[model samples]
Target: MSNSDFKGQIVVYSIVGCPFCMRAKQTLRDLELPFLDINLDSYGESVRKEVRERSGRSTVPQIFFNSKHVGGYDDLKALLADKVGLDRLIEEVKNNESPPEAPKVPDSSELKKEKIGDMDFTCELDEHAVLIRDLKMSGIIKDHRKGLTTHKNTFQANQFVDWLVKEKSFDDRATGIVSGQDLLDRGYAAAVKATRDGRFEDNDTLYRLLEHDQNSALNAGLTSECEARPASDLGEDLRKLILSLYNDFLTPDGKSVNYKGIAESSQFKMYTRMTAQLYRVDIKSATREEKIAFFINIYNALVIHGYVAVGAPTNLWQRYKFFNYVSYIIGGQLYSLNDIENGVLRANRKPIGSLSKPFSKSDLRLVVALDQPEPLIHFALVCGAKSCPPIKTYSGKDVMNELKLAAEAFLEGSDGCQVNADKKEVKCSQIFKWYREDFGKNDKDVAVFISNHMGPGEKKTSFLQVISQKDYKVSYMKYNWAINSQ
Candidate 1:
């Protein structure tokens, strides 16, 4: 298959700074395919509508090769795996080779253009003021005046103002000319500068500003806002914005934010407040299962976010707050933080003196008796620390995606199983050590569960065979009680 055939055949609809989008581009580059990247950030409502209608997915990093939707990052990876599929795509690209075209401009006839130096100023100033006020009240122009005030000194802002007046025909004097592009560019630049300078202190204020603007944009029907976007389409600036915002509002205490307070705060209500919004989304769910899953996922994500917030090592031990609390909860029903450390997780399971409590045995038995598939299974894993099995980031619609990623990430990072020329020995995760009964009818069940994913290699089979023979020695590793952070 010819690489040049793809020269004019690929159109990648992506947002900037999206990791998945970057991955897709890298894959295409590795395959020697030339393609056009349409930054969806610049896409107008009509263009976005066309994309959504065609793909039925609102997320970015949507790609069309030879007018066929290739799905998202996962799909692209799958296609590249098959040599025939890769070659076919390459052939199509070579046959359609042509010089790449410039970016397409969406049609917007309502945009009025005027020259600051030459055009007559007939549009009434009063009417424009009213329009601006209406936009602001409708939450479309969030702090428009503040944004415009900052633009007065910037060179790009001046150029944008000039463009609005001379090219877009907006009355420079009466409309107080400035382009939407100018606002976005300046907003992103400001967000980036803040991120690089480690401006965690200003995160709240910055997010409030963006939240205001997002409301304005939505009110104007300029964009649709959702929690989950394809990792490929977000631009660097936007991603930084999101990361900054996510880090800002996390409860330092590792406790859930007051639901009442969250509902009342405009800062928490806007979807642009990613962290606060995520909190609200989790707690607001009426379904108990959904709420439980949300809590588990957010708790795991927050543990990571907390480390980044403090500029600390993204390791489990560093996330002690969650681990200690969760471990306490798992050990028993403890009323307070002190009760857990001093009483439950710390207590000797075996009965002491006149106290008839057989602490260690019950703790062990409770853990053993608990079924693997119970909701508590998630909580138990979270408390597993570094040695525990990985907890997948729960996304409601894409359970499989999260599960597969979690499983693969865990296995790849683990040092458990290895196969020699004629023998196999795997140091399985402590999860198997602690919750052996949950795996199957017996210890052998855990071996089978892991082998399914380990593939049918001689090593995996040998390991399974050894477990079946009951000849393999079972040894427990020192389980890290440290929290899983980054």
Candidate 2:
């Protein structure tokens, strides 16, 4: 009934691997409402049946505002039509409201135990097997022996081999503990499988192997040999593997794979793995600029990887095309581009390209070279187009900071974006357009805010200035999304 009455109350019933669920979560976050999430995918059949009986929907994204059935995605959107639905729901919850209780699912541990052997091995095996198969299928692996090794981290090297054996159960190279070449082949295979299935877990495991190996090498006092393991040892093969995987997963016409699904599932794991690897780097061994350069390579690589995977156009001029999609992934998740840039790539006081260039896209680093403060780098990345810097992939360590910076920068930078005053028209950024809950008191607040941003000069102005100005019109600007070209 009152705003104060609904300070923090929201509940979302969702399923993992479901895009709708992710969308719903993003919606709630944009609204700034604290809500609990019930992941049905992790639940048992009995619980799912119970939920179905109560909600009368077998599909996921069953949301409750206060204690009422808010239905699925469409239903949620309907509630959002008035824009006050989220606010009202929060109020209702604060008033001690209870939505009709959906059946509760068991915890993850219980589910994991129950589903361990029952899992569709075909799916699991297919997901895993495909990694190796794709490498062979793509003809990327030249040698079954010698396996690739970036460093002398034997633990990671062993893990890489183990992952291959576990996934493929390939016995030929499984004996004698295999060489770096053999492990390299398996690693590439695993990566390919991950891309094909859109399974981040697999990719995460691979990254973990790299991190573990790096650590093992360091702990063994084998830094020289490990560090000298030549980029050629893994770079060329890795590049090819990543390229192929990206194409298979994201490209629509190539393989008809579900790029979006795979991206969502695997991105979280990828972020985690990458974070570990970056953090594990011997910063003392490498200069600050060198670290930033490494991150730049990773950032650009991921952008290219994501773009290819999504089957989006890759020309430099088409940067705006993928802004919304890129922003959604970066901003909606626990990890983001800014996390990598500021948290791990900490090359402040120096430009991004002041160091060496590992990748061909050396020119792209200039976009991040703007005079804006280090704190503003997140905003710069958010605005980064194909012509701009690649969106840095984030890790768990920097998630909170990344989210905060992204929200603030996006809001502030949006002030300079397209807005029309006269017709009470405002074509603000799609972020405001889509996740209106994130900005306004409801949706109306977003319009008012955009109107203020549209005002000229740096003076305190009234709502009248926003509404009455002749030039005030929201222009629908095309988002640039082309791959960064050097």
Q: lDDT per prediction? A: 0.39, 0.39
Error of 2 at 231 (Å): 33
**TM-scores, all models, native as reference:** 0.34, 0.28
Write one digit per residue (lDDT tens) for candidate 1, span 128-206. Answer: 2333233334432222234435321122334334444665467762342333332332221122122322232311223
Off by over 4 Å in 1: 1-288, 314-317, 325-421, 430-445, 452-486
Candidate 2 Cα lDDT to native: 0.39
> Candidate 1, TM-score vs. the true structure?
0.34
lDDT tens per residue, model 2, 40-147: 534555665665556655445677665477877667767777757665665667767454453333555546342211221111122223343333343222222224
Q: How many clashing pairs per prediction, in order?
A: 26, 38
Top TM-score prediction, candidate number: 1
lDDT of 2 at 11: 62
